[model samples]
Target chain A: MSNADHHLVAGAEGHQPSLAHHFSSHRQQYEAGKLGMWLFLLTEVLLFGGLFCAYAVFRANRPEIFIWAHQFLDKQLGALNTAVLITSSFTMALAVRCAQWDQRRLSAFFLTLTLVCACVFLGVKYVEYKHKWEEGLLWVRQFQPAEAAASLDESGTSDQQPRHAGIFFSIYFAMTGLHAVHVLAGMGAIGWVLVRTLRGHFNRQYFGPVDYVGLYWHLVDLIWIYLFPLFYLIH
Target chain B: MKPGPSSGTNLTHHNDQPFHAHVVPVIVLLAVFGALLGLTFLSLAATWIDLGTWNLWLAMGIATVKAALVALYFMHLRYDHSFYALVLAAALLFVLLFVCLTLLDTVEYYPDIHAIS
Candidate 1:
């Protein structure tokens, strides 16, 4: 338009390194980032979809077996763990919000809190799994649900062998194990984002990385929401 | 190839405002958590009555509700663009189709299915 206006536009166009060669502005970058994350989440659903199929088919074939197997689980522990994961997912969302506001300290703290809750979920899982394993409750060898039910304690697992209960544990371990793996991977990613946030890599305009990861973490939590009841609290 | 420049630079407001209104989302999250806990214990209680076959569907229904809550609020999907939710719904529909078909043909794969059924 004018001489000074032309120069100012030219200077701005030449300034920021974040500007893509083909892109006209920053808004496009954020939308593309959001789109790409959604695509990845689609694949994640398919991954869990496979396990859900197996679970459905098995439960259909052996309804009585599943019922017997479920009686052995501690529903109280499962509920507590569900609460832990839901809270962690909330903190993760807040961390993304904080990062968007350029609050590095609060963002880092929330991420750490999220990680702590994740560890607690894994810890509960470990205890539940380990107790099952020590009592010969794993799939393959000695999966005695009757013994497990009667035992209530570790030593009680010695009697009443229903080896076919392995089917339930197999399904349980497969679904929850895969979900746990995702949780571990998410923890690593969150830790990386926390490190980057501490270094001031995210501002209001460029917190896409943290935002994307937060979305991912919540998806993982969502999967667990389905899993906690399907496996542990099965009626 | 799709359009003009990239996505981020096109929008005038990059949503600088806080994500949620006051602590509304937090309150919602706690409410969801409490409900999930309630359903979980309810599932446990129902397990004892031998709902015959209803228990499985009942549990799955409760679990699906809990999953929806996490997806909507915890993932910010409720507050994000509508497109993400659409894509997720499509993926889930596909998964449902796949599960139903697989179960329908399940008898063919494992011949022993008849015996068990």
Candidate 2:
């Protein structure tokens, strides 16, 4: 009930070596770590929120550009990445659960699976980006839709390519590019957790690291949940 | 005190239990995962039907459901302390406010920008 009582209880039970000196008990430490992780995640939400706001403003002003630009995005590839990331999130969740259950081998397995899914997602992204680059469908200033530009020069008027089309690609690259970077960062975190799990560092009482990383990974998937429809599935 | 199921009280510290971590049941995890995938495909299918402005709204609505499922179950927010949810909700509220105010300003000045362009 009180901090003193918690310290007494922890001492009676034999203090967990993992428990930090500042905390009275393992639960206190766990809760503090979790709360800190959530607060960090909150900042992450606001960070991406700024980009989403910019997207909304641009999309509102020029609906035509979004409608026209979305066609260039490969819906099939986008859908694949969504499924992949969702699967990774599922594995990450399982890893945390396994760690909670003190099943180190299973937890490590799931983390490896999550890492694989992240790599697969990035592989698909590389393919998509490469195709766009080869076709010259890049962000503003570098945007030059190969066939559309040729037709525009010949006719002096091209409905196929709307004015300021570059703006659409600009937002596209910015949103997806940032999301991809997060995915890469997630892989690094997952890799570290996997190594820790293999080293037998986590058990039922000490899985805060896995849980925190799981939350971060889920946030990454959350961002893509919105990005997929906003960029790829737009009608 | 012996380690057992948490009594679902005491936010700060669980002094009564040896260890406390909500191990989500496998069935629940699978169910949430299935629902997430189902909603995703449903959103994709919704695109086939032409509803004009509603298409965007419908897609967004489905995505929001998926996001909620992830946050609630996968992230363990539902079983976790209320303060975590409160923190997330506050962040989302600010995002909504930020977007709305920015949009309002842009719409108000659109006429001038349109005339110039």
Candidate 3:
């Protein structure tokens, strides 16, 4: 090679600090970021996996409790939240697409829509949790059912005494509560991306942050897809 | 361990592009949304019918289909590198294993446990 080319490679080494010294190319850095995110997501799956295992074990031990207690959850509200999350996931996918196409305005719009949906989902959850609280259906130790629920037992519908039914609430609170935390975190991440997109930080050449956050948002929707049926559709 | 300095950089027109970064059509995304919402309604409706034990399985089956669609299309796992899909599958496999082993132990000890309770 020429002396000038060699000097170009050797000099100005600190020009782009964003590109780490270890990486040979932009593609490699992007791939490494994606791999790291996926590994983090894998750990997240295992975290929730343990909770799901607990849910299954408890449900197996006391089928009647789930059958009786799940009735307290409003299926319509759960279904509405399910639809809200799924729609938000779609918007998130579109936001990533717009960012890739370098359509900054569209990307910001879609991300805003997704953030709104996350808020709506949480609002519905608050309503559901409030109803449960009023009925005194709480976690194991603090659980105490209202008289209306006790009358169902008197009518021979479900022999599950109020206290015994706490298992379902335990699982419900643990799983959905954890999921709600993720939704809040997702909203924050989406808001961050939305601000950056509006400022034209991402475009066709550099949109990894938007894409990665879209994957995370979709995973949140994936978890809710399973949760709705499990908690609300128990016959 | 590094390659020689004389080695040519493997640059391509697509080098800057992320692997499998397809812009899914807006129609496709909406269609997926509609299908997910439809399935949610189906699961809700299924609860009204007295399917006995089959109810839970049916609901789970529907939910699984919806999850698969979201992962494959919305998350772009279908077009992305297969390694990421493998990672997800591995995580799910371990979850399945955990559930099955717990089920086996619980089923065996259930009666005795019930007697104590």
Candidate 4:
């Protein structure tokens, strides 16, 4: 192809330094990447969707089990984690915005804050999980709610513990365990982008990585939004 | 073409100038953050008053709102191309279909299972 034709093929708009050779322009590259990211996120939604369906099925079959079992979940800690995640999402959004504005330092700062929030979330999760372990509030095969049952009795709300209450813990561990894995993955991603931000790899011309990662992080937060109420706030 | 400076609007018309990245305002982000927190508290407070089955519905409804806010603004779905939104909607629709079908089957066969037990 002629030089002009090549320019047209490459992108009528001049070439961006960061633009991939195959893509025509920065916008095209960004749109393609974003569409791909959204598709990936769709699969994530469906993956979690299956678990949520299981939760519905079990809860519908035995609503009492959920009511009694949810009492074991510490609502205050769940609320605290929710707040922490929401704040992290806020900071992540700010990081994306700052990157879009080419504010490298500010973006890095926000990203650091997001990372810290993720750690806090995991720490709190550790505390909660440790408590569960101590009380043997685990999945069906490993469930040993003896101590938990005693506590419930002490509180004077023990009205014949629901049959197969371990099923609730099974679902809880399955759902939250998957979510915590995602949080760990999200931390790695944020850390990756944070390092890149420090290295000044991103500019307004190509902040797609930061933006996509932000989308993923927000999705992690979004899942928790539903999870928090379903698992901890069930009345 | 050179990427132009952001126009500093909540919803920048990406179609008009595809080169510029949409820079959402800090105020808008702060506002969304506040709304999300407010809804979180609202959902929590909902449990305090017994509304029978409505309590679950209320909590789920509030959580849905919070999820929407995160998806729309934090994830930039509002400022993004409609196709992205459509993709998400389609995924959600399929999820709904899957869950509903499964629940229907389970509920229909529940009596048979109970009889066998």
Candidate 5:
């Protein structure tokens, strides 16, 4: 029977089945897994949601500052990264599919592909971030920004307010930095699962680990989907 | 260690399939993937037109649609039990409630603050 049915059977027992240490019976484990994932997602939303709210707060206060900040960012790279992430999510789904169907080799291959896409994402981010870094745009409080803004042909001091631009960088780094951390964490988790998958540990019924990990990975993509338009497209 | 008839879910009836057991899921997945990409690009293009403040909302709406598709088909929430659906719906509702409450707090003073800008 499915782990699902095990849960049903356990419920039928006079004494709710003894949950295994990991889980008393399969029921407790599955419920726990789903609940845990949701709770984790809830926390993630609050974390990112806080930043989004901050964006709104600041944008409301200084629309011009936010607009000018968007101009300085490389929109093309941001859009490319968006496509890369969407593709990565697709590959991740494929990996889960492979696991669901018991295609070990194929699953491992897709997981590897997902990792490579993650790497490419980080690489592109590195380049964009390096450009920002060299331009003295990393948002150190004491630094002067008008001089840096002047160099960007159109950010003429008249329309630009670089000092206020500091807030944008602060938010940008905070948001994207946290996202990168999630990507790194995802890579580590996926690597572990991919290893297990290669060893033939999951089948259609047992693909929960891979399936859930894929869910987490998609959340990463979900955040980026919002981030792209908020930071790049909106302005 | 516990020798049971099956450790987890009931065994799949793979015996009937001669050589392969996955023609349908693959076809469905690919079709969904293509549609997802199409919708994503459509949303991106739509963003370029001026919809005023509503543009973001529109884009968010389209993106949400894409997300639902992925969650339903690509993620196989489609084939999963109704019980999982209830769990997910509850969690999503809770998230909505959380966002709404947060927004309520922030939106209260938005007008007063916007006047300063």
Candidate 6:
């Protein structure tokens, strides 16, 4: 039923099972798949690149709002999530390596670890979002400055409020929200790979799925690398 | 044109080819991970150094380094076919172009818009 199994059925006939009807060899199929994945990743870059451009525009127009609005974020949590995602990426690479060497057990172990890291990253994101909502820091029109906020003046007045502060939160929510979705998707992909690995579906000759999933996971981590510094550290 | 059973025999040596997927060593992966974490802390430290306008650049610079490490090693781009890397480079170029063009228009109209409002 799985592609791998379909390929296995072909293999039983003394032909390469993983090789598609349109492809002549496993190498050609793998190269085609890799090329397709690269094209998909390029689209992903442009997709997020648009959001990043928006963020840069808003920040350029009102640097002070970014300076003030970002104070509500907890750098420690962001940093922790960064480390979490990076470690997960490492495990993902190791998972691909293990699968390449036909080390099934190690491959499964690393995939499981990557899944755990994704969940932990999402959990931390939830905590951070909950804190933001508690402080009335929603996106756009819903953004409300917390009372007794240090960004306020000595009289605790409203006049000292930064202009267009909500824009910062808007960009923040959009970028990180999309990224969190990717994290969830990455978790699903890794889970699938783990299932396949456990079922003895993947070996050195048929690990394209694992390799592609690992690349996707690394791209997720790569996006967060930029997001962390832009949102949490630049202030 | 449909191929027969013998079609796959030609490309079976994919695993042995140079353009085939690179199986990054465990030790290399760990080293890259360590470097990524180190650069992370270095960027954090840059935030505390009061670089003023330079702070943003420093943070971005360090983040770029970390991103490069992930792409080149962890993502195995360095070992992948050059076409994949070229695709990524082109994507980045478009991103830069999009941002620059948008900013140019924004910068030109900002003063007029600000005065009118």
Q: Which candidate number maximizes lDDT?
A: 4
> Can you give the lDDT of residue B29 in candidate 1?
63
TM-score: model 1 vs. ground truth: 0.81
After superposing candidate 2 on the true structure, give the runs of residues whose Cα lies further than 4 Å from its correct spot: A1-5, A13-15, A148-159, B1-18
lDDT of 5 at A156: 54
Give model 3's DockQ, 2 decimals: 0.47
Which digits, one per residue and each the tens of the lDDT, describe model 6 over residues A174-227?
999999999998888899989989999876667889988988999999999999
Model 4 C-alpha RMSD to native:
4.2
Collision pairs in model 6: A7-A17
Query: Can you write out model 4's per-residue Cα lDDT over A171-210, one digit (the tens) per residue?
Result: 9999999999999999999999999999999886689999
Total colliding residue pairs, candidate 4: 2
lDDT of 2 at B107: 100
Model 5 chain A lowest lDDT segment of ten: A12-21
Off by over 4 Å in 5: A1-32, A140-143, A153-158, B1-24, B82-117
lDDT of 3 by residue, A121-229 (tens): 9999999999888888899897888674877778877755643778899899999999999999999999998988987776554688898898888888999988998
Query: What's the number of clashes in each of the models?
Result: 17, 0, 0, 2, 9, 1
lDDT of 1 by residue, B17-86 (tens): 4321211245666676567567656766776687756777887787787778777776656656667788
Evaluate all candidate structures by whole-model CA lDDT and list the values in order. Answer: 0.74, 0.85, 0.81, 0.87, 0.70, 0.82
lDDT of 2 by residue, A127-227 (tens): 99898898788988999787746755577543466779889889888988998999999999999999999998886667899999999999999999999
Better of 5 and 6 by lDDT: 6
Tell me each candidate's TM-score.
0.81, 0.92, 0.88, 0.92, 0.78, 0.89
| Tens digit per residue, CA lDDT, model 5, A74-138 | 77788778778878888898887777577889999999999999999999999988877877677
Task: Record all residue pairs in model 2 with backbone atoms less than 3 Å apart, i.e. clashing.
Answer: none
**Docking model 5 quality class:** incorrect
Looking at model 4, give its docking quality level. Answer: acceptable
Off by over 4 Å in 3: A1-21, A151-163, B1-20
